[model samples]
Target: MRATLMYSAGDVRVENVPDPVIKHPTDALVRITASCVCGSDLWPYASMKPEDGPARMGHEFIGIVEDTGSEVTTVKRGDLVVAPFAISDNTCEFCREGLHTSCAHAQANFWDGEAEEGGQAEAVRVPLADGTLVKLPVAPDSALIPSLLTLSDVFGTGYHAAVAGGVNERTRVTVIGDGAVGLLGVLSAKRLGAEQIILMGRHQARTDLGREFGATEVVSARGDEGIAQVRELTGGHGTHVVLECVGNMPAYQQATGIVRPGGVISRVGVPQYEEAPIGFGSLFRHNIRLAGGPAPVRAYIEELMPDILNGTIEPGKVFDTTTNLDGVPAGYQDMADRKSLKVLVKN
Candidate 1:
């Protein structure tokens, strides 16, 4: 088997690695059919040190179950399924409450390479098999594979941002980014019935998609200028919700600047900064609440899959490039260089 490994910043390799096998009664082995690079993966790809060299890459994927452990009952060998980015037992108290990312099970985890496997490979060992794998009605050759694969992470993540920010029919939203998650945030906000959607992004191509996804306005400016544009568009009132999908200090500051009092700033992008304003002038004085974390996408698969199936939305449009396992290294470079929105890897 061959898998992707980040040997250091800007250095990715697809090298031969050991194949996976079921190691626990709650585990299953999945042969990856489709997977892709995530925006968050770029964080490490930008600055990972030599000491942190060679970590397994990829968390989102759709695959066929090659085998399952004795305790796995929800799926069987040869079942086509989607694995959420996080591994969890859906029966846990947290999962029941729609927070599968916080699953208390010993084996539950995000795909951070602690398990010695990844979705960007020939196959992977899935822990919490019964609880983590969701059966897909589509076949291997379905045209909906790209859309279905988004359920594993990006679309669900965008939905989490909208849901957590309490977006509703009357709320106005400002999504701070035009990446896949941010563009999908526009879609999610539109689906949730937001009154207006303002997408902040510099890229013309991505912002164009944001409009199709439901952005009523696009602001390509940054810093105070960007804030002024959003305010002007909203009659100086800013917006009721700010979906901060760019996980940077500047993006956070923009969110704080553009959110109306009593609004929420939802952050789904993995933060690159450790320190941010949380004082009265930043959030407390305005009564603004900050929300969003790793999306518990496991809970959203069923809720989100139907729209993709019915063609109500096409979140898969985020994937502008496709490649095979061999093209993964170049695919990462394309995304890092802003030449691709997202890259889909097919086996």
Candidate 2:
């Protein structure tokens, strides 16, 4: 088997690795059919120190069940399934409350102390199979593969931001960032009936897709200028809600700056900073609320599956580049260089 490994920043390679096998009663061995590079994966690919040895890369994947441990019963051989980025025992208290990302036994599939668990490979060992894997009603058509794959992470994450921001029929929303997640955030807001959607992005191609995804306005400005653009569009009152999908300090600042006094800022971008100011003067003075974290993708998969299966939403359009397992490194480079919105790897 071959898998992707990051030896250091700007160095991603697909090399032969050991195949996976069921190691726990709750585990399942899946033969990956499709996988992709995530923006979060780029964080490490860009700045990881040389001393940090190669680490397995990738989390979003869809596949066919090859084998299952004795305790796995929800899925069987030949069933097509998707694995959320985080593996969780869905029976835990947090999972029961619809927060699978915080499950008591939660573990990132890509960091299971072994390289064989990565999604960007020939196969992976999925722990908590009964709880972490969502079985498709039937084997998906090739055209539906990318869309189903997004449900494993980005789409669910975007949906999380929208739900947390309280987007509704009367709400006016602004989504920061036009990455795959940001574009999906626009889509989620539209599906939830947001009255207005403003997307803050500089790329013409992505901003165009943002419009197709339901962004009523695209603000190409940055820094204070961007803030002014959003405010001007909102009648100087700022938006009723803000979705922060970039996870950078500047993007966070923009989110807090353009939200109305009583509005909420829902963030789902993988935070790159260690600390941020959220004191009284920054948030309490305006009565603004902040919410969001790693999306409980497993919790939302079932809810979003129908729309994806029926073709009502095409979040898969985010995958602007496609490649084979061997081309993953180039795929990463294309995304890191802003030449592509997202990359999908067909194994």
Candidate 3:
């Protein structure tokens, strides 16, 4: 089997690796059909990541179940399924409460070790199979492949951010960033009935997709200028809700600055640092609600799947490029350099 491995900063390689085998009674082995490089993957690929050994990269995928552990029963061999990036046992207390991303067992599974194998490979071993895998209605059309694959992460995550930010019939939402997740955030806001959608972007192509996804306005500003424009658009009140899709420090502050006093700022970006300063003073004074983190993808997938199937949400539009497993490095470069919105990898 071949997999994407991260050796160090700016060092990503496609190399042969051992095939995965089920190691837990609740685990299943999947033959990845389609996988994509996530914005999160770039964090480690473009900077220092701590690990004693080579780490399998990627975590967003749609695949066929090759085999399942003894306890697995919801899915059988040959079923096509979408696996959420976070592994969870749906029956746990947290999972039952719709907080699968914070499931005790799932979070505990990561705290003791170097983390599990990633999805950017030919095949992967997925734990919590019954809870994590959501079987699609049928083998999707080739045209639907990219969209279906997005349910594993970005689309689902973007939807979570919109929901957390409280998009509704009268809300004006601003999405910061033009990446895959940000583009999907625009779609999410539209679907949830936001009255106005503004996407802050620098690229024409990405802004165009923001329109396709229902952005009513596009601001071609960066840093303070962008934040000021977003504020101006909202009649000096700023946005009712703001979606922060970029994980870095600058984007994080911009997200906070561009929302109304009582607005909600939802961050889907994975912050690169262990300690990030939240502007608690402004938050406390303005009564703004700050929310978001790794999207609870498992809890939201069931509701979101129907929208994707019916074409109500065209999240696939975010996949501006597609390539094979061997072209993993180019996939990273294109995204890192903003040449592509997102890349879909075929196994």
Candidate 4:
């Protein structure tokens, strides 16, 4: 079998590797049908840091179950499943409280474990299969493949952030990025009944998609100017909810600068590191709520899956390009260089 390997930061290659087998009683070996690159993957792919040799590169996928352990009862060998990026047992205390991402048995393989079984490869050995993989009610059509694949990450994640931020019918929300996750944040806000969706971005294609997703206003602001523009649009009061999609210092400040005193700032961006400083005093003075983290995608997948299946939400629109598993390195490059919004790999 051929799989993607990351020798080090800024180095990714396609190499022939041994296939994965079920190693745990709760594990399932999945034959990946489709997988996609994530913005988070670009962090290690373009940086200078130590990474696992031959580490798998992707996490969002929709695949057919090739085999499952005797304990796996939610799905069978032939079922098509959307596997979330994080593995969880779904029965843990945190999982029961809708925090599956923090489940006691949750596991994420992008940085460790079997490097050959990440979502970017031809196949993956899914841990906690019964809880980590969501079985679709029917076999998805080819055209719906991208949307189904998104259920594994971006779509559900974005929805979780928006909901956590309390974007309601009367809320005027400001979204702080233009990535696929950011675009989906706009959609999630709209679906949650936000009346005025303000999307901050400069890319025409991404901005256009933001509008389609439900952005009532588009702000092409980059730095201080962008923050001022957001204030002006809200009568100097700022928005009611701010969605921080970029996991960088600049975007973090932008999110804090443009929300009302009592507003909620929900951040879903996967931070590369946790060394940055946040103004706790300012947050307390303004009575703002700062809430966000890796999305508990499983908690929302069941509810969001039906919408994706019915064509009510087009999360697949985020997948701007596709490539074979062998071109995984190029996919990372394109996404990092802003050459593509998202790319899918056919496994």
Candidate with the greatest lDDT versus the true structure: 1
Per-residue lDDT over 1-347 for candidate 1, one digit per residue giving the tens place of the 0 to 100 score? 99999899999999999989788988999999999999988998999998977899999999999999999999999999999999999998999999999999888899984549889999999999999999999998899999999999999999999999999999999999999999999999999999799999999999999999999999999999999999999989899999999899999999999999999999999898899999999999989999999999999999999999999988999999999999999999999999999999999
Better structure of 1 and 2 per TM-score: 1
TM-score, cand. 2: 0.97
* Model 2 agreement with the true structure over 229-266: per-residue lDDT tens digits: 99999999899889999999999999888999999999
User: Given candidate 2, what's the lDDT at residue 157?
Assistant: 93
- The candidate, 1 or 2, that scores higher on lDDT is 1
Query: C-alpha displacement of 305 in model 2, angstroms?
Result: 1.0
Residue by residue across 243-323, what tens digits does model 3's lDDT show?
999878787778778888888989999876566545666576788888988888888888888887887777988888889
Query: What lDDT score goes with residue 334 in model 3?
Result: 88
| Per-model lDDT | 0.94, 0.89, 0.84, 0.85
Q: What TM-score would each prediction reach against the true structure? A: 0.99, 0.97, 0.94, 0.95
lDDT of 2 at 219: 97
Worst 10 residues of 1 by lDDT: 106-115
Q: What are the root-mean-square deviations of the candidates from the true structure over C-alphas?
A: 0.7, 1.4, 2.1, 1.8
- State residue 36's C-alpha deviation in candidate 4, in Å: 0.4
Query: Poorest 10 consecutive residues of model 3 by lDDT?
Result: 106-115
- Model 2 ranges with Cα > 4 A deviation: 106-116
